[model samples]
Target: MASRLAAALLAVPSAAAAELPAADLLIVGGEVHDGTGAAGRTADIAVRDDRIVYVGPDGERAVHAARILDASGLLVMPGFIDPHTHADGDLLSSDPDRRENPAYLHQGVTTVVIGNDGGGSPDIAEKAAGLENAGVGTNVGLMVGFGPVREEVLGETNRAPTADELARMQRRVARAICQGALGFSTGLHYAPQTFAETGEIVALTREAGKRGAIYDSHLRDESSYSTGLKASVAEAIAIGREAGAPVHIAHIKALGPDVWGSSGEIIDMVDEARARGQRVTADQYPWRASGTRISNALVPRWALDGGMPGLRARFDDPEAAARLRTEMAENLRRRGGAETLLITRGIGDADRWDGKTLAEVAAAMGSKPIEAAIAILRRSDARVASFNMDRSDIEAFAVQPWVMTGSDGSTGHPRKYATYPKAYRDLVTSGKLDLPTFVRRSSGLVADTLGLTNRGYLEADAFADIVIIDAERFVPRAGYANPEELSEGVVHLIVNGSLAIENGRPTGVHSGRVLLRQPSRGTCP
Candidate 1:
């Protein structure tokens, strides 16, 4: 079959090469899912100078020139645009010689939005320049984080931003957007950010929102931790209203036992919001377990109030330490206890503790699970895969059209290398969702959400970010035990007319660019 397809592609008996405009590459006779939420058609895709010049039936306008690739019997679709990721840190920290992002390309991702969770750099232009100058494996976009902006203005003080300080934060957010941040993101559940009042976040959102930037957030709380998951969703929605920007909830989930069936409620709220003309959407990983640091899940946000100094001071005082322990115990309960947390990435010296459950580690140390967790936090924090979600909730959210796919992570969880494929294999292929809908949510919806002009679709003149997949073989090979393994079955990947993956092998081409938000497209400086 491979040979036949190759023969068919090589024999390009159409318009003469000299008669047609030049093309960098041509993919012929494939099932073309145009990333438009419509059924695919058999067509040929042609790339030239970083853009798709043609997409139609086999002997189309863009076909005569360039190399021919036979994608016959495979799915040729838009290379995925992941809305949330932490890969910027990865690429920046990668060995200079090996800057290619294997984890994403292996999973068929061609673009990733970094600096997510309110932790993306404030100096987006600087990061963009660095990535472009150093060369990157995939097209990367930035989102200025609320966390950094707040830290810059408030210095981790547990208080509301003064009016003057608030003014400075607004300027920072506006500056990031002008320099090309796709949106403003918030890790409201995390520190310094958690110290912010709802009104303060609304003020920051307006700065980005008025620039047509998206308001994306890892909600203040997903479980019953702070205001309960429902209230957190409502708070996000309210912020959207005050800011006049679309609201996007990050890694939307009904986390923990208390929030088990809350997917229904969350879906309804978003549905009703849209019905009322509010633009609200959310991204979710395919896996049930969520990835985060050990301190984040078990420690109460209140105890970590004044940053490291406050935390150290509390730990030093015996009474405060006892109170901290009690609060930490309650926080652990909300996540269904320590057994639900699996340490995936360990800190220095404690590296041997990876791959063990918190409960198991506690048993080995002859200490209570909470005590062991506290000790581990004191020594060093490790990333964990918290298995506190219900399978029903994951699927329930998966089927919702407003719920798009995002890894919400990097390295520590299987989702980093498996989110899209898992969704495709389990949802689309298994008939829970039709193919068009899957493509729409995964690529088109996300692109539309971010207002990316020529990406996430296979139309003529769009960026040549495409992927050819063997649906049957495009499976997530990485498991919790061996979390670093790359995914499989991406036969070809093209990013901005450069072949990053060709015929099932990585070519290490850093053909990616930092996408700038066009001011003409309703964005402000």
Candidate 2:
């Protein structure tokens, strides 16, 4: 094995080396999905210069290659694309290898969309160039963040922007898109961003539309009432309608028990938008609980107007405290109470409460779960997890023809490790989504939706981004209670015609590049 690896290394050029033959790599004896939602077939894929050269059974017999991989008993499909992620940390951090994304590769994710929930790098151009120079484990892309952009310009106030201010923000969005941001992403439920009116969103989103970019949003609400799921869907549709942009609701969900059956309505809205010729789509992760910050549990938008400091002062003030408690009662009811919330991460001692539910921690503190939630946020710095979402709602969205799968999360989250696998195991192998259609949503649909060419397909001219998994044994092992664990059954992952993962282990090769949306190609509508 060592000698073979050495020989392979000698054959491949260093990152700085000049050009080489395109069909230098070969993968044989694998069942290919073709990334077009087609049935699997036995075929050998040939690659050269990072692009697929040949994709057929008979043509590979006479083909000679520098490296050959035996993929017998494995399903070779397009690498999974995480449509939503918080990997900005991975993108900008000092480390250049991007080892932290192994959890994604374990589940066969070859590409990820960072800059989610309105938080990410301030300079998309610099970040993109840096990641390309540093090298990474998987393909990465940027979505200009509304939160950081707002914070950069407006600070922590929740008021309507002046016409001049709005115009400046619009220019920033346009500049970022031209600098290679896939689209504009917003977390309107969070502070600063949430404070902006709907018109503000529409105006800025139009900038992305002019560049033919998509508007992916976390929505203004996911809770039960008063800016809840229905209103959230309405906002996304209206943004698309008003701005003439393709809209994608990030991590689309109907949260809370009161809105348990509202998934159908959300679907209907997306369908209606598409039917009316307004481009709209959504992504979902296969999980029963959504993750967020603990501070988000009880703090009102007004109280959080100044970011962390303002919220802390309000928590510390007795007069403000009293009013916050009254609001807290409503928040508890809206969130189905603190028992449904969990502390995911925080300061030094926070990791101890990582998997414990809100009820458990609250009981330990001898206080109501809501109070415990506030206490933890205050002490640990405001990170918490909400045990929201229904299995039926997850399945309903997962099986939709227009809905594609997304992790909608990041490291140490169950979705990060098990989302793709669980979706395939539950929705596909369990007879919910037919094999072809399932693979299509997981691979092709996303590629087409994101305007990613030479990927999401096993075709003659596509990038050799493929995954070989044991379909029967492929299932997500990570859960809400046990997040951060690796999944089972993904045997190999190929990135850009190179092996990034082998036999379910990362090969430490960071060959993935930034995939920017190229509207000039006329691929994305």
Candidate 3:
């Protein structure tokens, strides 16, 4: 079958070698699932100068071309665009081949949005250039982080931003957008940012808006009964109103037993905002649990008042340490207890601690869960996954037409390899959702939400970021116990009209770009 498909692709037309040179590559004979909200069909795809030139039935005449790949008996579709990710530092470090990222590509993800949670390198342009120079395996783009910028300027202290500070932040945001940031992101749940008054964030969002950028955020809280969940959503709405930027809630979730069925309310709120002329959207991973830092679960906003130094000082002071522990104990109960948190990544001796329930770790240490939480925070900094989401809530949010699918995952979680596949296996193959609806949420909906042009559909003249997989054999190989395994059933992947992956394997190609936000274009920037 491979040989036949290769022969069929080789038969496509090409110009003379000396004059303009033959096209870079051609792919033919596969089931094409254009990222559009449409069904799959068999078609031929041609590439010239890294852009898709033709997409139709393979013709009869055999013509010359530079390279060709066969994708017969495969499920071909648009390479996935992960709207939420935190792979910026990973892409810049020594292991930039990003073996973890291929787990995404093998599952049909060709492009990813990094710099999420308001935590990205300060120099985004440099980081983008470095990734391109080092030959990245997947397309990478980013959003400037409001939290990090605040941390850099204010050192995690709680206070209102003076007028000068606000201006400085806005200028920084504009520079980042000009340097290649798709938008601005915030993590109001984390420090320094949590201390920020609503008006400051609104101001920053407006700066991004002027550049035609979007505003994405991990809201202040997702589980609390009082102002925690609602206030966070309101904050994002407010930012959108003031900034004139589209508001995108990061990893929209209804976590804990307390809020098991709160998805409807959240959706209604977003709808209300939209009714008021505010552009709001959200993304979610297909998982029953959410991951984050241990400190995030325990450390009080006041305890972490002075950045790392302040926290370290409090850890050493006996009286202050006791007070910190007491506050953490209350926070643990508020967050559904230590049993809800699981260690995912750790350093040194903590490596053996991964996958253990926080309760188990506390028991082994002969300490209370709150004490154990403090110990882990002091020892490993913040690197834990909290099992806080409700399964019904996950399913409810996923089916929303306006709610796009995203792997709110990192290299540490199986969702990095399994989010889309898991959705396909459980939702579509199991009959919970039709194939077209699933594809619409995963591809077209996300593309449309971000205003990405020319790649979501398989029509002529579109950038060919495509994927092909086997529906029957499709399954997520990664699990919570072994979170790094690659997925199965992805037979081929094409990015920007180039064969980036073939037969469930990476072709080691580096044909991606840093997409920035510009006043002229919506997302291709």
* Strongest candidate by TM-score: 1
| Candidate 3 backbone clash number | 11
> Which segments of candidate 3 are over 4 A away from where they belong?
1-24, 58-72, 316-323, 520-525
Clashing pairs in 2: 22-48, 22-49, 23-47, 23-48, 34-458, 294-383, 294-384
- Candidate 1 error regions (>4 Å): 1-17, 60-62, 94-98, 520-525
* lDDT scores in order: 0.86, 0.79, 0.75
Per-residue lDDT tens digits for candidate 1, residues 170-276, read 98988898888888999999998998889998998987778888999999999998899999999999999899889999999998998999899989999999999
lDDT of 2 by residue, 376-442 (tens): 7676654566767888888888877788888876655687678888888787778888878877887
lDDT of 2: 0.79
Question: If the candidates were sorted by their lDDT against the true structure, best first, what order would they fall in?
Answer: 1, 2, 3
Better of 2 and 3 by TM-score: 2
Error of 1 at 375 (Å): 1.0
Q: Write the per-residue lDDT of candidate 3 for residues 1-525, one digit (tens) a residue.
A: 456755544554333323433456666677776666677788867667746667777521322346666667766666778889766655566775762357678777777888888886557778777777776666777878987788777767888888998888877887787776877899888887888878888888887787777898999888773357777788788888888899999999976666668888888899898888888988888887677777777787777788667887898999999898888777777667888777888766677778888898989999988777777666676466777777778877777767777887775778877888998887888787777777767776666766566656666677777777788777899988888888888877777776677766778776676554444344224
Q: Model 2: runs farther than 4 Å from truth? A: 1-22, 519-525
Instruction: Report the number of the highest-lDDT candidate.
Output: 1
Q: How many steric clashes does model 1 contain? A: 1
